[model samples]
Target: MTTSESRDEAVGSGDVDFDHHSLTFRDHPHEALAELRSRGPVLHSSAHDGFWVLTDYASVFEAAKDDARFSSAESVGIPASGMPFPILPIESDPPQTQQLRAITMTPFSPGTVKSLQPDMREIATELIDAFIERGECDLVQELTTPLPARLMLRMLGFDESTWRSWVERVHLVIHDRAHDLDAAMTAAGSLLTELGTEMERRREAAPTSDLYARIVHGSVDGVPLDDVQITMYGFLMMLGGMDTTSGLTSNSLLQLCVQPNLRQRLIDDRSLLPAATEEFLRHDTPTLGLARTVTEDATMAGQSLKAGERALLMWAGANRDPAVFENPDEIDFDRENKRHLAFGVGKHRCLGSNLAREMFKVMIDEILTRLPDFRLAGEPVRFSDAGEVHALRHLPVIFTPGPRRK
Candidate 1:
């Protein structure tokens, strides 16, 4: 049989069609991955134009570190989107990636995130007040969506009024691909154009600590980033920070909605929230795994891969590998090794993880304290194509009224 037919049969000869970019994994990622892992360590998927899926932790982490062999110099899109411009350090290889990463690191430093905590809490509280007395609200629409957008505004020195526009447009660009590709690209183009204008504006103004100023004035190898590079960096910040965290918040909250028992567990012991956070990240990671290109022909987990090929380092799959975690499907916050590949592994690890963690902690804490009894008001909506971003489009919840905090 040809490789295409074999890949089609890779998941038990027609029993289940497993494609990394298909609605199958997006809707049933755990179930589908459990089946794939049972087959072997790696399987070729015809999804998103055919790519390799890394099914185990060992394989994913190893390939992540071994960039020379599984290089990230080209488009990292699982199906390889052939992006016109690089997403800065993420698309750059080795030495150059290092330099670009350095220029982008200072703004997301731990200290910076710590200083932003008060702002984070304030944002969460303000969001709760908007619909707290209504006895029901779509958590994704009311809180999760706006939280990241507003935070990004504050972090990057954008006008607070534009937060809603930014949030709506960014969500469309990243998560609406399945329903509307033209709209997604249009949203992306608008964001990039706005970013270019913002970058130029910041450059002409006084330097500040916000990411915009840093990127506009920040130098790489003692040279300022050119228009394309600066704009790309800004684009990455908006893309990387906004929708991913929004989805993470929505996904984690959905678990709380469905698993009432888990909610009580968190309520009983708030300290476990940190552990719970890690567990949620492990089980229902929001963003899809980034793409890595194959530098040369190689064999991984008994699968023969050719040079110039792309491999999706699927973190969502690896974190659930039973070989690595005992009772892989179950959520155990007490697991000794809480280190999941949620933020990814290796040099390309998430730069803004600290910011993300703080947002999750603050958002969840606010929800539990204010609306402990919130339950699903309606069915949650998810994306049609789980290829790029695994997120909820809508999540409605019902709860009793609570006094708004000043």
Candidate 2:
């Protein structure tokens, strides 16, 4: 159908020409999101070629779980990335999605992630030591960004020295996509080249424990994955492993910088860090949300949607619904039902959740113990647009100069 027809069918209550990537939305999403949610559970936005916005807990939850009617096969980004290859598992529906997910499941599995904690802690320590005696640092560049990238490289058997390049490429694609589509596409192409080259190398070598080797030799129903499929797997892994965790960690640290009491509380009782992590995730929601296509003519949140229409499941909105969580705007570590949709929900839930959580706790623990007096040296710089991933580009912080722990 034409874009006009799509808009016509989407006309209903709660209608607004909402653009999640808009400057207004990025600068003040909480206020904008609250206004959107107050309109109704679902609203039609004549943005990104026209799509419905699922703004409440029930509607977002229902749509996310019932993927049959609300499909992910078409695209997950509001304005699609326009990549040459499909983003596995996330951008695909069932069967193929499940198969692709299974191939990478082992590396991101809870058990596997748990085993990497010591290394995670060591990386955090080494990163802190790099600038501990300097009295100040940019947390995003010095710590958050590299920690995940280095870990991912270690898992893929790639040299960790190239972590900065990997981080830049992934960040360019994710944080720059909204404003600079061409740059994002170019970064994606570069990523594909690097990943493709590595996959080729793995193909000629004997299978091993690294994630690259696994994907290179992996199969679906006994059929070996093609080079394109392997590259896509690598692409997805790089994005998943690097971006969201850094965003979540950096956002949480920003909170501590602004809320001294919160920092002191966590320092006093480190156990509270885990609960605080959940609350931070619920409030900050690094991933914001993902997009889905209406598979068949369906009614959701009392709104009519036609097949091929797009709907954005706003996790950030759903996580703050008053009906579900008390004082939804406030961060409550004591929240009993911390079942927030930060990592998302249902079949497409984040596979790296365990690792992300562990990484967050470890980073927070190290920071609190060593740089307990750290405070913001300047305003944190958020990404230009946060439609796909909510992130900070810089977090300048200062503390009493200390000796390098390592």
Candidate 3:
């Protein structure tokens, strides 16, 4: 177990020194997770006032589905997001999760998400047009970041120009939380306030098809959603929508840089992208893992967990479990069993998964078509946090200057 600080020193002799947010974990997460999995499927970590780490596929998958026993109502982050309100959907259990999810799931349905292809392509083209002639651009800033942010803004019924602030606020809250907890909470609070204001505006405006309108006008069990519910739901949308795809796409692009053969395969045959997308989602999972609170005393993988104890379901590690995925470390687009928990499992699965896949495919298609020879211009600067969304802060790439589609 190689780390900046020795294990005993970090853990104080009694508990396992498994700080998910540690520098070692951040730098080489797969290695860190593999080491943890090697130890056992369920190990108590001394980090963040102690929590159980579920590493294997069975434990994580089972726990994810058993929300009755492993509740999400408490906190999804190990250190607990000190937000005054729940993030909605993901932070709630069963009945409430289902109700809240139903409100926003309509727009993300396969048909609806598929209909947005043209719009996504248009957005992708316009973004690429801004940088195609430059020969080099930070992919994160120039493409990966704004594409989703702009689309999320449109969905939220907000002005596209405000994407930058929304993106920054989301990044600060999710990606930078491990570094500065206070700043992250502050950003979360501020974003909630901003979202609340937007919801109020939506209330006065005519009925629209945007997400904000859906939440503002939405009802659960025939009762209209309250202001807090509206804001929290909208806040979840802002966080999940803007961050995950950005990280997944940016991370996949980095993978292409190191694996030239994979890049060429994609360039040669565009049909393989859909499969590749699944593999990438599995291999470079964006939301590393989420925490679950034990509803009652239960034994999982033969480990006793008392009531109220916290357990971190390591989704990334589970995806790579050799017991489920053969040659798990290697990238394989032809993987027949693409049933990975990258978006999670059971009732709490990512509601926007359909849109996320479509977004990834569209962005990849546009980039691979326009910039076939793209290569890493510089090292990618990854976010320091591994507690939630495992994302790259910046990914610099260069390619032969080309003409804009627009």
Best by TM-score: 2
Q: Write model 1 residue lDDT over 381-403, tens digit each, in one string.
A: 98676777788879999999999
Mind giving the per-residue lDDT tens digits that candidate 3 earns over 15-69?
4678888877888888888988887788888678889898899999999998888
Better of 2 and 3 by lDDT: 3
CA shift at 158, candidate 2, in angstroms? 1.1
Best by lDDT: 3
Evaluate candidate 3 by giving its C-alpha RMSD to the native, one decimal.
Answer: 4.6
Residue runs of model 2 more than 4 Å from their true location after superposition: 1-12
- lDDT against the true structure, per candidate, is 0.79, 0.87, 0.87
Q: What is the number of residue pairs that collide in model 1?
A: 0
Q: What is the TM-score of each candidate against the true structure?
A: 0.93, 0.96, 0.95
> What is candidate 2's lDDT per residue for 89-120, written digit by digit as tens?
68887777788778878888889999999999
Alpha-carbon runs more than 4 Å astray in model 3: 1-15
